[model samples]
Target chain A: MNQEIRDGLRAAVPVIISAAPFGVLFGALAVDNGLSVFEAVTMSATVFAGASQMVGIELFGQSIAPWLIVFSVFAVNFRHVLYSAAIGRRMVSFTPLQKGLSFFLLTDPQFAIAEARYEAGHRLTFRWYATSGLALYVFWIAETWLGALFGRLLPDSHALGLDFLLTIYFLGLVMSFRKRALWLPVVLASSVASIIAFNVVGSPWHVSLGALAGILVAAAAPLEGVREDEANEGRADA
Target chain B: MSDGTTLLVILGAALATFATRAGGHLVLSRFRSIHPRVEAGLNAVPAAVLTTIVAPAAFNGGVAELGALAVAALASLRFGMTTLFAAGAVTLIGLRALGL
Candidate 1:
């Protein structure tokens, strides 16, 4: 294998290792939240968005409307659109099949790696993305299965506050972009909007409203300078 | 949740999640040259979206938790700790103390 492929695989291994415990946690939580083994495993296999899956289970436990649950999950994960767009723009040179396959494998960490590669002017192909994705896929399914089997046996995880893992993960992600003052306002506004929506509209709609508010506000704000700065940085790195 | 209905709901949720995850790629596949406006929108979307999601978690906590996250963010900026490590460390400490 070429060095690029080797590097891609090397990068992907850490992600897979990290995902293993997360996957197991999801699997265990799904069962604890009252999903059957098949149901939990199927959801993990088919859906593959960890946060949305957890939220869906929580909503279901609370007897929320199914359509609302679906909508909420969609809203929470809408950022994938931007990720897909970024990858799609670059994969324009590839074939339709190549593009489709790559799209299927675009998860958060994978997208992060891919973007870093792109900004570095590295030659990232569909195959590279696919390799990383396939690795994650295996770990995800395995972890879910393990969790479903062993999750019920475990003690109260809520007391352990394992649920806060997602929160911490998001905080880390947001902090990474804290270089600019503009992001601080964006974060504050969105948080306030989401909290208000959560109280007013309640469960599912709260997520949608909060996400919409954030998207609209961020888009309308002046970000031309930030964009130019990022592009310049990317060019300099190249 | 009825078992049958729950199964259906789970399936629906999974499908919905997949759709959103896949939606952007499907939309972008047809385009050759993306409009500059669309590009701008896409670039800003993550910051907006992530900010919305993270805000509740960071501040929803009590004063101590909020303080910890603030400290973590400051540490990230000043000390140059990786965002993930710093945030994780702060949350671990804060939540442990809060007994949440």
Candidate 2:
């Protein structure tokens, strides 16, 4: 294997390992919520993002219109736009095919690793990111299937309090951000907005409002020469 | 929903997600440099987006949510993602087991 690919896999292990519980959680949630095991596995393989899939499944359970569910998934995943923008500038010379595949496998973890490397002066080639991203892709897909099958065996994941895994998972994801001066205000603004929006707007739309709130705060954040959020992008959680 | 319906939704989600993933480069890669402010916004978005989900759950939920998130948040900042996750899961499971 290429050494960077090998390094990518090595770097991906922690992320893959960390995500295992949520994959299982998603699988279990899908089966109980509305989906068959096959559908859950398929979603895991293709959709990849746990939060959106879970929300999709929830909307499915509610018998919401299919079009609305897709829209929600899109809005929740809009963060990938920012993710793609952040890294696209760094990997400007990649072929369209390379960029497509890399982005297809994109998730927060690989982005985190890449951001850290880029900020630290490591100029990564397409293969470095592709190999890393693919590693996470495989791990995530397999775990989703396992969770679906095993969750079926459990009869009621809620009885076991597995439902709480969603909130617990969010804790890890939220806390993964690098602590900085701008972090709290951005978090506070988005979080408050999200709560209000959740009551009025609902799942995916609420997420959009929250993301927009955070982006706006970040854009106009008052500070003097402290580029902390920049240096800290990929520094946390790994 | 039928199996076909579920499959369609999943496909839609996949396509939408893939679109976002590939979108940045398709549109922005032609540009020579990223604006510093855009980078900051992107950098802040992850935490901001996630906090919207987690912070309220921690504050609103009772002992189980509060304990799991509190421990996880502290552990994440100090230990790392995997460890904090383990800590959070353990806390939630323990609290539920104890009827908290």
Residue-by-residue lDDT tens digits, candidate 1, A1-238: 9676676787676466545667888888888888888988888777787767888787877878778888877776766776776566667467877776666567777776675566546777766777777777777888899999997576564544454544544554556555533566666666788788767776545545665665565556654655676645544543
The weakest ten consecutive residues by lDDT in model 2 chain A span A229-238
Local accuracy of candidate 2 as per-residue lDDT tens digits, B1-100: 8888889989999999999888866776565444556556767766776677765566568887688778887887677656777888788778877889
Error of 1 at B7 (Å): 6.1
Q: In model 1, which regions exceed 4 Å deviation?
A: A1-22, A55-79, A116-124, A155-161, A178-185, A203-208, A221-238, B1-14, B28-32, B78-87, B94-100
Candidates' chain B TM-scores in the order shown? 0.69, 0.74
Model 2 off-target regions past 4 Å?
A: A1-18, A25-39, A57-69, A92-94, A108-128, A147-150, A155-161, A164-176, A179-181, A226-238, B1-9
Docking class of 1: acceptable
Model 1 is docked with a DockQ of 0.39
In model 2, chain B matches the true chain B with a TM-score of 0.74
- Can you write out model 2's per-residue Cα lDDT over A121-194, one digit (the tens) per residue? 67878878988888888878888888788876655544455656656655565655555447777888888888
